[model samples]
Target: MVTKGAMLWLACTYDLDGGTLGHLRWRDEEVRTVILAIPTSTPQCSTSFPDNYRIDCNLASNEVRLGILNPVHGDTYTCSVYLSDATLKGWVLTQVSIIVPVPNVTLTSPVSDTVTVTPGDSQVYTYVTGSCRPPARIDWYKDGVNVTNQTGSVSNDGDEFVTTSSFTLTGAKDDRPATVQCRASNVDGMTPVQSGVKTLVVQCPPEIPTNIQEMENTETTIIVQWTEGFNGGQPQTFVILYRPEGGTKTETVSVIEQQQSTYTKEITGLIPNTRYLLNMYAYNVVGNSSLSSVVDIISKTNQECSYKGEMTSIPNLASIALFITSSVLLVTAVFLVMCIICRRKLRKMRGRENNPVAEAGVNLPLSPVGQHDISTERSHYDDLNLEEREPPSNYECLGSNAAANVNTQASTDDRQMYESLGTRSNAAVYDELEGPASRAHVII
Candidate 1:
């Protein structure tokens, strides 16, 4: 069947020697036509036809044409041929019908409006219409709400019209999986056709955690903890950075797949008696957060007191023993050296006490003048010769020069007295002694 407003043409073939009348019938009215003496024809639509219909006829060719055909004209259409000649049949008829089709609606572009976007961002979207005999109207929806902010336009293709709808969307907090749709409709009032549902995903960066602290500490490790912060509406992971204070390089530790509101992490492989600076940050699908303020901490230095492991290795025990032995040896050696030095000084003092005269040397005084050299004279007397002579002992009265006129005389008693005085050879009498060179009296 022909569509509404389409042209309908009908032709009848006949054997004719004379002029004929051709009429087209639609509904209950006839389409009129006139044939002149020539072969040309004039056609007119009947009053029952649509107001915009036009008719044309070819009498010579036995054809009729209907323009702007409408369903209102009728379901059945008959084109008739009437003959003016008696020999021809009275009527020649051909029939057809007209039909108006239902409008088809579809979406051509943006099969689905689902998309991913950063939080607090804006985006542009395009929706196009699929092929439709009659142009379809496009409508936009966001979050299941009809959108009026956008405008649509139509363009012609080979046999159908395409409509495109474009719009801008500003992101919001609730934009995660935000649904968007494009619906098409026509005058038929049938069910509206739509594109598949679309979604806008909103991702965000992680927030900085709060109140970080060193929960536990030791010589070689520390346990860190903190209260969690907002996760930027998404899952997050944490990164911890630590370094020795005033150090140029840093060490890193990571915490992943974390979903809790608080956290604790242990850091190991550190040095004792060292200072450290610690900071932390978090990250998610969007980006990383700002680094937290750094904290200062000092590791314990007293390994023996603070370390948990035992110092039971052979080398350590041996070192302890060696240290004690060395200290004792050093003290003993110092004491021995001091004792030797003191002993040498005491011996030198004793030697000075033992030889005082020898030590005086030539400093002694000489004998006094006019005094006999008593020791030297005593030594000479001991050296005198005393050999083989009988003793004569006597008392004599001498003159002034008695010693000059000496005589040998002795009394028996005097001799006996002399004999009583033991002598190997001697003559002795009472007399005066002499000094070294001058005479002096002596009693004998």
Candidate 2:
């Protein structure tokens, strides 16, 4: 027995223990242990025994603490450790502490915005979750609902989370706006943080035209027009498909790229009052759709059998007709002005040709009349003899028989080939017209 104030270490131990006094039993398939009660009120009982006693197993690793109920220098202590079967107990009683749960969660990336995906395009997103130590698991939702499909989407690949939530639109639903979201979870399911809404918009292909209109009365061909909604991007091409308004698809139809998105279409070989449908589709580089829209064109018949006099018709709408007439007259005046300009140019050209001889005459020197001839009588030959004049330094062709006179320096080949014009003695005259044989001058 240990005294109340006496420090007593493990003074003794017992070899055998049963379930009676805190003898631990595994109760299942595990460790069993035992707890020995060291009494502080009986120090003499403890020290009175021998310091060494045999414990069945080594007890080196056991926590020691002052007894909770007893106040002593070190008379008694309590130990807590793994319950080993060697001692006869199955489990150990360990100390416990209370921990408060953290409620703060952080999300990164995948901002709150709409995701635009063309037809046949897969949408991709990136995000991460945070709390305090253990990371979180992420999940995606569509239209405020959870995604439970395993094969089609939401799979883990080397720590990278991906989804294949593809929505088919063509031949089904046209482009409609949808939403996508992300959810995070931890060990405690109570607190879950959902990311901001991510809007997803899907698209589908376009359909053919319905009703069409025609100009004048034409049965075989009609000008079809339609109103088209805004298609996302400029695609490679738009396919123009057409079929009879109420006829079967087996009938002769048309499909071409040259006839895409044009408001006016020429539908041929159709009977009068027949109906036809037209479809157009525009696509982007990635082949996404929501292409051009379609409309129907209705054909009209050709019928004309009336002739009304313009005099009566013109009188009724004279004011309006005059306004139109004035506009036409203004255009006609502009055309007349252009014609007058062209005629004046032609006349100028004609005048140049007609007066060439007169100009040549003016260039010639006046012939000397006889001084003795008092004959004031005008003669027809008076103007005819007006010839002998100085020739231009640059050669001018007047008469076919006139001799060409060169009057300046020229190449050595000049005098060797042709004789001079002024005289045989004045050979220098012909040399100037030859210019330089080394250099060739182009003549018109």
Candidate 3:
């Protein structure tokens, strides 16, 4: 096979005697046109051929040559040799198969070099090649990476072939600004013609805001700041949703400026000593992003009020008053119960001291001596100044006044007993009386 713009030659030979007086003719079957003719009557080649063709006649060698300059594809050339007697001697056929390199490639689908599309959207791009022989092979590429699976078709326009290739582009945010190219090659060792670069702009929703922070706070306001995320190939703004902690009512605020990488918002008219929750997001014409991480903020207490640390719940005035009143009432009730118990114990102790014999459930015998003697003994007991006294021990009651007569005789023993009782402590005397009481008499 030869390439286009090359030369081709067709020759015809005949075996006849000398002075045969024959002529040669060349005809193209594709176009149905005669290209060149040579006659044996003339000494030189024919001058009637096209400027791109030539003819050579040699009667002695019995041959004729038809030379084609810049021959094209899909043409069958016929060289016929005949005598002047209108008798055909011999003929030859030459088929032309020329390879035409692709001239220029163009992207017809997108029209412009830059194409804008949203994420998850499919875009079709078509590359068409100029007319070529042995139809050009079309290939597609994206970001300099070859695309193996592509669709194409070839159509013949007269004598040349035109190839068309289509590529479907689908991508996400990460694949934005992708470059696509189409290449066409028809002949071996020929550089493939490349179409202009087509850029893909994938527009998508912005990413969630990051690095959320609480900058500053006051008694009735709070300041928040955050870093912006990807803008999704367009201008974007930030919005914040804020509310009191555990409150149903919410408020929304947006940044005044657009396309800023960092933003700050100040929220006002908030309650003092109150906790608040905040969330932020970025948005564009496409859509809004997911909510960012939550940021917690607590407003400061008023200057006159005592500071409460980081507590979300705020107690009302009525509740505080009620709590204090309940505590005071509980303390008063406990004190009254203690007073009643002490009074009852004091009354019981006084009764025991007033009538020791009756309290102890024991009977004591009356003194057998005269009333003067009893009075004298009671006087002596009063002189002792003892707060607690033990009952008399080891003395029997006498039936008559005769006990008085023995008083003088037992005077020494009574003196010894009195000394022993004097040695006893008040607690010892009280302990002896508190135990089971026995019937006893005093020695008058």
TM-score of each: 0.44, 0.30, 0.48
Reference-based lDDT, each prediction: 0.56, 0.40, 0.70
Ranking by lDDT: 3, 1, 2
- After superposition, the stretches of candidate 3 with alpha carbons farther than 4 Å from their true spots are 1-66, 70-72, 77-94, 99-116, 144-151, 189-197, 215-230, 246-272, 302-444
**lDDT of candidate 1 over 181-210, digit per residue (tens):** 767764356566776776766667877887
Q: Tell me model 3's lDDT, rounded to 2 decimals.
A: 0.70
The top-ranked prediction according to lDDT is 3
CA error at residue 207 for candidate 3, angstroms: 2.9
Higher-TM-score candidate among 1 and 2? Answer: 1
Q: Give the best candidate by TM-score.
A: 3
Root-mean-square deviation of every model:
19.9, 27.3, 16.1
* Candidate 3 residue-wise lDDT, 1-444, digit = tens: 677777877677677554464566677775443543445344445644467677666656777776778776666888776666867777778888888788999878888888878878889998888998878888788999998533269899778889888889986776648899888898768898888888988888888988888898887888888888877876777888988999999999988446457788888998887899999888888888999878888898754243575545456677899999999999999999999999999966764454343332222222322323442234323222343445445332222342454555454443454445557864554344344322123432
Error of 1 at 178 (Å): 4.6
User: Clashing residue pairs, candidate 3?
Assistant: none
